[model samples]
Target: MSLNRRCSRTACGRPAVSTLTYVYADQTAVLGPLATFAEPHAYDLCEVHSERLSAPRGWDVLRLAPDPNAIGPTTDDLLALADAVREAARPVPVTVSAPSAETGREVARKGHLRMLTSE
Candidate 1:
């Protein structure tokens, strides 16, 4: 499901790592992280193009730096992912919940566990 987007600049085939859009009224060029989806008014730029991006005379170019902490998966994230996989791989019990006349349908599903918090 990954998007294989290329730089919008002509003849530059590098992979897009940032998105650029202009604010016509304000005369500003905004360069930010890669957009979730391609926008008609936005242009995709590569690392090189993004670094060398410049605005026209009297225009401002706003560059949004990516968060350093969000660059990669942390150790805790990896461990949590592993734990989730292990939990999902485990076998389920034979007990089945059914609605009975004495009581209404089960308020909550059984056997399915979601990792809501660390604890």
Candidate 2:
């Protein structure tokens, strides 16, 4: 039993390696890497199906391939993720600064909001 997501084509149960989406306004069919999540309008395709993909008359098919030598999820990516998590988890210090004359004073405090007096 394979855990891979299957191709969207009917009767083709092969694992999907790419994703296909149509740009109706541009008359273009884009084939790129497998999406992080399945979209309602996008179609997941296997290698064979992706290679055999075609567009209708006056439509262009754009195949976006990954860089051959580029390897992702490196140490920098992990470090950046960790840094972002730490920044998000860190407590935000609250400060009440004196309002300038032009800005006016805060009149009412509401849920995640504050009403200010007009000048």
Candidate 3:
């Protein structure tokens, strides 16, 4: 349940405080607050790494101010989470129709499991 992500730097076990992403085409590096999710191309950096980060010789670095209030979830975040929980808890209507032989594949799914029909 831990939401914190570890820094991408080797030997640095600190929690990530910022995210680093490079724009190859523009030869620019962007450093900002930790992302809500781990992006495949972005690097998660600790406070120290983020502060000490330097771009390549020809690259420019863009550092964004990390919002102090973003360290924790806000009221809107809590309310959104509550709304999502309520939505998930509500019963969903599932209309099962006889599968046509021509289209035997599963048409839809919900959550993690699949509803398979025997052909």
Candidate 4:
């Protein structure tokens, strides 16, 4: 399921692509790419609202660049996944022995795989 946030503008349901926050002290409106987590005081906005955003006539608007890390998974992620799959697929020899008469149970273990004792 997608956890994308929707625009905060009334009547608009588009997914948020940026975040809007005001710096009251500096009289500045900060517009940047959507944050990793939603902030209680910040407003999440869609592409259109973000592009059309404007601060008060005398206030400054600070636009920050999109975060590169939030774009998506990188090559490293795929490489690590591939390595894990390869290691899991690599076969390992397993040794089996007859059940002990005293215990009357059989158990086997190989790598991370385990077999429960059967009476």
Candidate 5:
């Protein structure tokens, strides 16, 4: 393996984005991201490195992505995860009933929520 844990695949340098945690019954393997070389970047282990990843106690792991070089949980990582959650939670389009007598008042009172749930 390369000293930097870079992707073993030639002509590609994308860093591993996430670890492929494999669980087979009781065995598991944690594959680490190998590398990615550009923006919107995610590095992942090459097939070779991925195959080599061995989980102690026979756990099977597949692969991870982004930068495997990234070590330790930091505040930034937590914030990033939170941002991802927020992005995923973004509302999709929903059908709304026409304003009823009370509905107009409800909408007026819940304008903020309406905006939040808007498509």
Candidate 6:
């Protein structure tokens, strides 16, 4: 089910960005972005995956556990998960102007991708 508060992980103060829903007796745990705008579906995430959900890298850690006993959203309970997801996924509209030609050209000159080395 969707949690109202942030992740229980103390070091990760980031909000609970996903759900770890396990269906009763099921061997899978459904993991979904807490920000999904649609109805929550059955998508299981393993222990490692759930931990990464709120990670700072903006990476989705949703994954299926290898063993069925791990955790999985049961077909029995239908929590008010969609509502929470919609709330988290609410989009904030913003506008950005096109980059100037100079900026684009400079980036091209530096190559498509650049890696910074410590000074």
Q: For candidate 6, report its TM-score.
A: 0.26
* Residues forming the 10-long window of minimal summed lDDT in candidate 4: 97-106
Model 2: number of backbone collisions: 0
Q: Write the per-residue lDDT of candidate 5 for residues 16-90, one digit (tens) a residue.
A: 333354445656555554332322333355555455555565445554454545565578979998999999998
4 or 6, which is superior by TM-score? 4
- Estimate candidate 6's RMSD in Å: 18.7
Best by TM-score: 2
Of 1 and 3, the candidate ahead on lDDT is 3
Model 6: ten consecutive residues of lowest lDDT: 103-112
Per-model lDDT: 0.82, 0.83, 0.83, 0.83, 0.49, 0.45
Off by over 4 Å in 1: 71-119
Cα lDDT of model 3 overall?
A: 0.83
lDDT of model 3, residue 13? 97
For residues 1-119, what per-residue lDDT tens digits would candidate 1 score against the true structure? 12589999999999999999999999999999887789998999999999999999999999998766675667998999999999999987544455544434443344663222221
lDDT digits (tens) for residues 1-119 of candidate 2: 12378999999989998999999999999998887678999999999999999999999999999556645556897999999999999875544445545577766554466566777
- What tens digits encode model 6's per-residue C-alpha lDDT throughout 16-57? 545565444444445655433323443333334476554324
Worst 10 residues of 2 by lDDT: 93-102
Q: Candidate 2 lDDT (Cα, whole model)? A: 0.83
* TM, every model: 0.55, 0.61, 0.58, 0.55, 0.24, 0.26
lDDT measured at residue 118 in model 4 versus the true structure, 0 to 100:
56
